[model samples]
Each structure stands twice: as C-alpha cells, then as structure tokens.
Target: MNLATSPATQTAPATLTDFFLKWEKSQPEKIYLRQPVGDAFIDYTWAEVGQQARRMATYLQSLGLPHGSNIGLVSKNCAHWLIADLAIFFSGHVSVPFYATLNAGQIQQVMEHSGCQALFVGKLDDNPNRWAGMKPGVPAGVNLIGFPDYAAINDADLVPWDHIMATCDPLQAVYQPQPDDLYTIIYTSGTTGNPKGVMIDYRAVAEAVSHTSVIMKHNTPNARFFSYLPLCHVAERNVVQATSLATGGTVYFAESLETFAKNLAVAKPTHFLAVPRIWTKFQLGILAKMPQKKLDLFLKIPILSGIVKKKIREGLGLNEAVLILTGAAPMPKSLILWFRRLGIIIQEAYGMTENLGAVSMMPTNDIRDGSVGKVYPGMAVKIDPQTGEILTKSGWLMRGYYKEPTLTASVLQDGWLATGDVGTLDKDGYLTITGRVKEMYKTAKGEYIAPSQIEFGFADNMFVEQICVAGQHLPQPLALIVLSDMGRQAERIAVERSLEDTINALNPKLHNYERVRKVVIVRDPWTVDNNLMTPTMKIKRNVIEARYDAQLQPWYENDEVIIWE
Candidate 1:
C-alpha cells in the first residue's frame, strides 16, 4: 500500500474498469444473470446490473466505512449477492464470502476473523437461522441489510441494506482499483481447528478467469454457465463468475440443491462446474432408478448399450453443456467413465486457493482419465522429485496469506508455490494427482496407503455415497463408507439383505491392501456445514478421522463385515 505516485502512472486511473465499462457500453440490455425462482427466472441485463452496482457502491460509501474494509456476505447462489460483490469493488472495499452452511458460531468466527466491517444478507438459505440469529443490535461500523426483512436501509428505522440501495444514487465513486489489491478472505471449511482465512488479490482472480475461459472455449457471448458451487470459494467466484464476466457469458444460479438438476435443464447451460461428491450422487440416482441387473445386461450388448446411454444423456440435461467440468475434489475415474459412457465428458481441473483457481486443467478436446489435463496458459508446473509434490508458478498465484508471513513464506518460495499435493506428470505432460502429502497414512505393518486412490476406486459403486480410508496403525487400511440414500433405505428391509450381498460381491475384486476390512455406514451426509467437507466439497480427512474414531472400535471388536446398524 505504498500510496506513492509514479511518473508514467501519474493518473490514479480506475483499475480493470476497462472490462466491465466496455461491457456496459456494448450490450447494456443483454441478460447477464438468469436466476431461477420456482419455475421461472429473473434476468438481469448488463446495464441493469451496472445501475444497481452503482447504487450499492454509493450506499456502501454513505455508511462512512473505511476504504479497503472487508464486507461479509452470507447467502446462496443468487444475482443479488453478485450485485453486492461488484458494488464493494466499485467502492474500493474487499468482500469476505461466508459459506451459508456454517453455524452461528462459525459465522461469527469467520466474520470477526476476516475483520468484516459490515454484513450483507441476501435471500435466506437453508442455514438462514444461523446467519440471522447472530448478536441482535448492529454495532458502530457493522450493519445488517437484508431486503424484505426490515425498513429502509439508509433511514433512521435502520432498514435492511437492500432497501437503502433502492433509494441511493446510481452514480457513486468508481474504485480505481489495482491488480495487487486484496479481494477476498475465505476461510477453509475443515472440520477441526479455527478456520484459516486465505487472502488473494484481484489480479490472481482475473487471471484464473482468463485462463479458465480459454480452456473451456468460452470466449464469446453464446457461452451459458450454471452457477452451482458456493461463491465463497475462489473456484466458483473465479471460474464461474470471473469467467462469465470475461467471456460475456450469461450465468444462471440455481434456486437450491433440490432444484439443481431441474434448473440446469431450464437454463441449458453450455458450461457447468460441480464437485466430485455431487457427480457421485448423480451416478447413484441414475443407477437406483434403473434395473441394475437388466442395465448391466444391456450394457454388455454392443448396440443396445449405445442406445441406452444416449437416452440417459438426454435425461441428465448434460446434452447441453458444451463444457462439463469437475473439480474442488478428486473425482473417481469410475465416475468420469460412467459419464463418458453416456456421452457426457466430465473434464477434471486441478488447483488450490493458493494458486487462485486451476493451475492445470484437462483441456476439453484432449481429456484423459487419471490426468488433470495440461498446465494452464500461464501456469508453470514442476514436480518435486524427492517428495512427489506438485509445485506451481504463475502470475495468478496468491499475493500471500493474510497477515501470516511465515505461512505465506512456507508455501511461496523462490517464486513457486509448493502445492503439497503429491502428483506426477505423465510423458505427455498431463498431470496425475496421486494424493495429498499430509493425507497419506501408514498401516500397522508400515505399509503406505493413499486413501484418495482407494476412494476413487469405489466412486461409481451404486451403494456407496462416501468412502474414507482409515485403520492407521492397524493391520491394514479400512474404508468407512457412507451409503447412498438407496442403500440406506434398503438397509432396514429385505433390500438390506440384497445390498449386503451386492457390497460383499464388489469387495473381493479390490487389491488385498485396498479391500475394505470394515465398511462403516454413516447416517449423516458429509457437508460443509458439518465440517466433514471443504467449502468446495472436498472430504476433509482430518475431520473424518476425528468424527468416526470411536465408532471404528466396534468393527474391530465384533469382526463384522459392515459395522453400522
């Protein structure tokens, strides 16, 4: 923050204002966001959105908050949230995105930790109570502004924030922001320990969008995008939001998790991004509705298999997505191939918050299994020979972790960020991620196990919802599985007997060390709110081990094939 004036850069001109300003001037009425309601959607044009953003920026400045202060936003995928984000930028402020899944305590922790000066509540989500039930009165610099819940935002009645936006001026201060300015502070959604805030800059975000849009072939206005992942993570913000803006693509935000598929069909998105867990769930839903035995028989038929798959593709709404991308977690190869069989190619991308979004992604045209495609346009990737760690260097790499110099130094060294993910580059330069160096565990007999590897093997299994490799310091690695809804429903009746038979049948084919000695079926689903998964939907090994540590004993004690009741 050296406010020093330079000779050539004497004018304190607007930062990256060129992108949006040009867009507003070009297609002012072109729809940018198509957010779905129950059966319909409300579309926001570029000019319309820009007008709202201007009002929001003026309203934000009217509060007399400090420049560059963090503003917390809690909501689901909605157009209003995105509107507020741009407004914050226009006013020269930072946005701290909070996962709507967190509990009250967690929300407070993240807000305070990120030093958020104000909070903007968009439409109520599943976890609305936690966000709304925070300490009652607004403080000196902190305020609550949720529309339809309170009076005018700028009035003495202390109206909600959105209400105030309606009356504010549509011409406020334009943020002449720079590339190096801090943009967001997102806390990791791991189960244990206080969440760690990862800080990144605007240039890193824009760079991620630029490269991703190119890789996805989304360079024009015709590219339609589906916004499903949490905007709190850089993955969604950079990939979906920034990419859409960079390419002039229209983004459609789903109403909720339950309406996701239906909304996808309605939007007919050309680009879609999803976490691996959701993809696995989609596989289960399709398999459960079909007669598995009969389907297997048809799959064996040379001609019938293609016919069956063609029908499945149309039903899944995947026939529209020109680029169906998967990341935020390691996707099982089985799941990808299952989609491929249906003529839906799910390409995988690899990266972390430290690298902005994706450092390397499987190109849409040259996709291959067990590989996260080629290094992105500007990213330089190198594998550590000694430890097999993946290292990346790029202009998009994060400026540094917020206020944690030592932590930042550890990851960023010699102009390269140590990814900590153990991976290798194939002869063709496609990256194959093996496992996390920290997540790899040793068995009682000193055998090493990569749990992600084992979990991917069972990803397409019809009965398994989630599988975590465990049994460290034991004779062998064991898998703790969370069964699918179909498998769980079947567990209490005659179906339980059939499912047990099916699960037992699949176990024998696994390698001796990889075979699940005890399958512990969990009642609860893994979620970001429960701390079992990351905000980006990655399974947190540490969280899984801690939550199920006690229950694992019964499996060892009873000598049971499946431990859960």
Candidate 2:
C-alpha cells in the first residue's frame, strides 16, 4: 500500500518566509518559540519572532550582499538558529549551516568552500578563543554577527546580534522567494572527507513540511517541538523548524546537554524524533530507575503491566508523545520491541541527506520487525538487483552537491539517487538495510563480513553502549566495544564474564565466518570532540581504524576473549 497516497492533503505554505508571515498574522499572540533562560522559559510570540526576523532581514539587506549570496550559520541548536535561518531566506540569501561541533580548521574549510559573504556565530563553548585560528579562513571583508554569550573574537566587522535586532528597522519589503529558489546549503557531517553541501530548494522544503506535518500529526496548535539536535542536519531542519512553521506549532529549545532531560519534560512534545543513540540513552534512563529483571517480572502481572508502562513513559518524559521516530542509523528490533512493551513505538525511518532524511517511515499500525516500513507516497524506491543498493527518486530530492556536478552525477544517476546503502526489499516493499557497500570488508581468509549485521547482533546486550566489528585482513572479526556507564560501574570481572557468556551464546547462532573472535573494551568513549564520531553520533570507521589498527594486532593475538584497552 502506498502510504503517501492518503486521502488527506495538507496545504503547504508557498515559501518559508510566507509561512512565517502567515503564522504571525493568524496567531500573533501564540507562543512560537520558547527558549530556556535560567530556570525560566523566555517565550517569543509569533509576532515577536517575525519582527526579529524582519529586522534581521533588513540588516542583511543593508549589507548589500549579492542576491543568492551564501551566509554561513555556525551555532548549536537554539532558538536563534531558526531566527537566523528564517532571516537568511527572507533576505534572499542562502543559509549555509555548519555543524557547531566543528573546529576552526573544519569551519574554515566549509566557509571557504561555500563562499559565505558573512558568518553568524552563536552559542559556542564557554571559550571563544578556541576558534582564534578560524578568523583567517573568512574571506577579506566578510561580515561577522555574534549572538549573546558568544565568545569575543578579534574581527573588525563584528556585529552584535542584539544591536541588529534592536537598532535595525523591520524590512518593509520582503523578498518573494520562488518555489525553485535556493533556501539552504546543508553540509553533510561526513565520517570521512570534506563535507558536501546539499542544495535544498524552497519547493522541497515546502513538500517536506507538508508531508512530515501530516505524517506526524503536527496540525494542531498544541503540537510542541523540542529542538536539541543540530539545526544543520536535514532531520532537525525539516522536522522541528519546517514542521513548526508549516503547522504553526510551539517549539522549545534545549539549553545544554545537562538540561536535555529537564527540557524534554518541560516541552512534552507530541512529535519527537531522534537518532538511535538518544533512544538508547532513554532506554538506559528507564532501566536505571527500574532494574530490568524487576520490570520484566512486573510486566508478567497483567494488571500491573499497564501501570508499569505508564510510569515508565511518564518518567522518561515521553508520555505525551504521539509520534516517535528514530533514524540516521538502524535501530535494533530487540530495542524496538523493548520500547513496544512499554507502549512507546519508535518508528525507524530510512533516508539520506540527499533525500532530506526520510524516504520511508514505519507505519504506526503496520510495523514489522527488521523493516524500515514502506516508501512514502510520491517517492519511488527500488533495490539494484545486482548490487543490492537502495535507490530512491522523488520530486523532493536535493538539487545536487554544490559546485560538484561530476560528484553529483555519480550518485544521482538518471533520476534515482544511488543511496550507497545495500539493502533488500521484502515482497511487501519493506526495506531492510543490510550494510553500506563501502563498509563491507573481507578477512585474510577471503570471507566477507558485514560489520553492521554483527553490530546489530550485539545491540540487545545492555552492558554495551556502542559496538563496531572490524576484521579487515584478519582471521576473525574483532568487536571494539564501548561499555555503558552501568557496565563501567560493574565489577570488571563480572562485566567480562557476562560479555564472554554473551559472545558464546551469540556465536552458535552465527555462521562460523561471521562469529566475533575477541572484544576490545575501549577506555575512551567515541565522541565528536575526539573526531571519532560524526555530529549525528555515527562512528567514523576510517577514523577508528586509523586510531586503533596498530593496537588491533595485539588485541587480535591476545588469548583472552575480552581485553581492556
């Protein structure tokens, strides 16, 4: 069944700027964006936000930037990110969002490549001096706008955000954006190589807003959004900002990592979307409150099960969620089933930066194990019979990589985007992503191993947080494991024993060639700061391999099943 062909049709705003104006006109007094500031939420009404955006637009216009000029946005997820994005688009310039976690060198690379005429900096770490070297990367005479709490940089053209909003008059004449006008150039947080800018137009943005709002039930005024993920990614941009704009919903901003849970509880968003890492953390949070064994025993009691589920949902700040989604990586079925028992059905989705983050979504009632549901309406997806690669085509696909027509052609062949992900489509059109074609490797024995499959096999192990299977040119696969906080606190001997038992039980179910031989307990957890993971929380295999391949030789030869790094 085509999920996209539903009878209900949502009317999308002509342009993002038009949507902002419409909401300002219809719901002037409604709270559009709520930002947490020192134990209180500073609410910005639609009228207020629109006013600031207009003032920003006026300021942007006064700079005399060329039409379609790229203006870089460097910041973590915050209320101002949306304001900057709206302002950029409204002023007829393209917004270029860079991952906030990127260092000065990385930021320079992106800024140079995108040819940003001006850069807006917001909410950097406590110290701004870390990016001292980044100043040279900005072209001569480029403008710099710094938001509140921003670290002071030694740039002559710095413009304070407060001054712009307070002194600048509201733009009287708004630039009307064409449906095909460039909206934003989103840089992919690639695990390897320089980031590629994906060109998303106003039409794609409009369609995404229309479809996602309908799919996630974001039509009501009470629909709340908690924006914590980096706004640079298409997922957060489409789901949080665009959906809120299209539906006229309320959005709350997370203050910091320490306040994420509190912020979530306060927002109680009806629609929540996150990557698998966050979902795993939520599961861990629940398990911390109620031991797994005790919860399992209570679930067996018919009457107590419902009560337990309710408590779990409310405790995790998910009781109000109507549609929950997990994407950017494959979530384990075991993990999904565990949440299902608690009445939280996390729908896994499939998409890429090229496709704006959701080609398929697991239908609420039709979810099946190991499938990323079916393709959305108006999108076509099929697997390459020979290569098993997932390919998709739709009106909403990205225009192409900026300034790289050859590279774009390599991926966007004919009409379909070659997804690089190898997967199989079931008879019912459900897709099960097997692995990335580039990530598959062969051992010295000439046996091919798909690390993702091996990683998924270990997903149910509560003691493990992140696992990566590596065995390139080796006799057997090796598991690079990062133990969870609970696992780290357990007695070393106990955790090792449990892991050994886990491997022993799992080995019998796997082919001899696919069985993991040993495990390396990595001392330091992989993080974006360490350059071991992408901002989206996926481990960078190339970075990992380069960092630990030498140690692999010793770990591979070790007699122990689990070795401490």
lDDT of 1 by residue, 1-565 (tens): 0011112212232233556777788989899888887898788999988898898888888878988998988777788788888888888899887776666677767766677788876655554464445433333457766643321222343346556666898864588778788877766665346776788777666665555555767565477888878888777876677767776778888787788878877777777788887887777778777866877888889899988887776676666677788888888787788778667888888888788767777776677778887777667778887898888887677777776789889989998899879988765667889888888888777777878876665565566777788887667666777777777666454434544564577558666765666666667888765678766766778878887777666665666656664
Cα displacement (angstroms), candidate 2, residue 410, comes to 0.5
Off by over 4 Å in 1: 1-17, 134-141, 147-158, 293-311, 491-515
Query: Per-residue lDDT of 1-565 in model 2, one digit per residue for the tens?
Result: 2213222245544667778888899999999999897689878899888888889999999899899999998888777778888889879999998887777678878888999989888876534564564565666777888766556434446788888888999986778888889988999998778899999998887776666556767666588888988889988887788778877899998888888888888888887888998988988888888899999999999999999999888866789988788888889898999999989989988888899886888988787889888777667778887788888877678999999999999999888899899887776667788999899999888988889988887888888998889879788999999999889889999989989888988888888998999999999999988999998999998789878888887899998889998
Clashing pairs in 1: 145-161, 151-159, 152-159, 362-373
How far is 504's C-alpha from truth in model 2 (Å)? 1.6
In model 2, the clashing pairs are 4-377
What TM-score do all the candidates reach, one by one?
0.88, 0.95
Q: What is the C-alpha local distance difference test score of each model?
A: 0.73, 0.84
